[model samples]
Target: MENAAWYVLPNEADIETPSLIFYVDRIKENIRLLINMIDDKSRLRPHVKTHKCIEVTQLLLHAGIKKFKCATIAEAEMLGLSGADDVLLAYQPVGANILRFIKLIKQFPNTNFSCLVDDFKVAAQLAEQASAEDCIIQIYIDLNVGMNRTGVLVNEATALFKQLSKLKNLSMIGLHAYDGHIHDSEMRVRKEKSKPIIEILKNLSKELEEIGGRKLNIVAGGTPTFPIYAKETDFDCSPGTFVLWDKGYQDAYSEQPFLPAALVISRVISQPAKELICLDLGYKAVASEKPLLNRVFFLNAPELHVESQSEEHLVLSDTKSHSYKIGTVLYGLPYHICPTVALYEKAVILDADGNIQYWDIIARKRKITI
Candidate 1:
């Protein structure tokens, strides 16, 4: 995914169907545009769950990005191996995961690792393990701005922070306020809904700084509210999908400068009916979270209507009466590119010189070498 001085594409004949094609130029452009938007690389702590490749992480590092946010320990491990200096495991670790997380930190001593905690009981467990390992683990208090997911409520954050401060071997570094609820397509509506939550953080940061006696880093927002969060200098923005813009986000947020860097290239395999053709792009290749229409945007055959989709086949009805011969190549922009990328083991990365190479999905698997 990293752009080298010499880049190009591979022979079309060598590529198999249902393969992910990653554009090197577009990836680099996205990185540059994000940095330019932030006006400083230090303000951005991009999530790595989108593209799990080490090359992509290295690309971000090359762009002067040091901090990274990930959802899993596997992703954190990949980041550590990629020489990422600082990484935040955004999800709260529970059960045996607490010990696994501590082990990860020990393995990558050079990488400053942190995880989220909404409950003091989980924080207590983490503190115990960190104490056992004789290591101090950094933690971010997960604050629920609007999303009723994993974070502690805004009103309860300060109390939990105070409780976490008392836990042994656990450092309350900052607050993780993820407002995934404010995903209005319109920027004005998105901003309006996110304003109160932003204020909550502003107030919370002031309270924490005064009481904690230090500047507390607030990592907030996702792809939709990235622009709004970017304006706040004190908050560190963690937007994942901005790296490889997908049809879903690109259509919703047209103002974002990111290009469709990731795509699923399928081929017409069978002419089942007069105007109906079967494609190799199935639910296995694409993310089925969205509806059929929003699942993928057919680049070549925009007029094609999706008839049905199964594990390995996607039937489409071409209304234009245009006939595509069997084996004809077609490209599709997945609506949800994150899970779509996860479906594939490796990507057929195309360079500027028309040469194709493969990049392994290093963090795609569930477990690391723990």
Candidate 2:
């Protein structure tokens, strides 16, 4: 009695369509590798900025990772609310938005919260606010290790540490030195570049202790430099990207050890020619910063090439004359996971059978300016 022309209905929600998905098994394995790589005295304070998903955070928590390094107050707040006992805000807070920070403190009164500061004035302000609230705030001294980013110069960090020690409500907890710019195509070169920075940190730790300053609790590193720093340095590591390994990290290592859990599931919306195809997702879906280098990878069609990407369209050319018809699904591995994740509203979590289990995008819009 069934009609011969009946077609199977496409369930867009059940498929990984334009959504980032995390393979839980792969994530757990990577966490195991990270933990096994470290010594008994080491701790893993994985950066929460990479995934920013409470689910992924929960998985890391279950994997014996209690300490987390967050880029924004929102991320810290989210982790605190989601039952993360300790969270560190690894960015300097600016502006008059002290109310938001205070709210977070009050909301998670029992939780251990900290923030990074390069200047004593800002530390004093935060201490003043914490003092008014009758709360203690932990502070991390951010030292510049040749990145020339948000940290204070290595030579100037000790003076800043002295200033922070005077703040009544602020407790100097640890040091944070992130060498993000030294990642290279060669592992030896990257490790060699990080040695001087690690040496500076060791010396700084010694100087801080000599002055009878507060003991260092957390010495953190960003995700990209974790491998080099983990082996050489005696500090707590913070590598977030290892949870959901991306194409960029894979390319940098030149070895594909981890599976590409997060992918942009795009469909061919147009076919301009027999050898050319266009996709619906473009710069808005993936990162536009290093488009040519980071993006344009083949998952299903190795012969297909990602020629160009506009705001909303991706032009693909098949060099081997592989014709892609309209409505064909393609998976792309993004170069940078953080920025690409920030662009989406939701992520689809997949099961072992490639079935969409659930979608979580709760922290996607939890960005704070301060």
Best by TM-score: 1
Q: Model 2, 64-159: lDDT tens per residue?
A: 778888877878876886688788888877665455676777788767887788987777788888888888777788888888888899878878
Clashes of each: 12, 0
lDDT of 2: 0.74
lDDT of 1 at 161: 80
TM, every model? 0.96, 0.90
lDDT of each: 0.88, 0.74
Q: After superposition, how far is residue 10 of candidate 1 from its true place, in Å?
A: 6.6
Candidate 1, superposed: residue stretches over 4 Å from native: 1-10, 351-353
State the weakest 10-residue window (summed lDDT) of model 2: 1-10
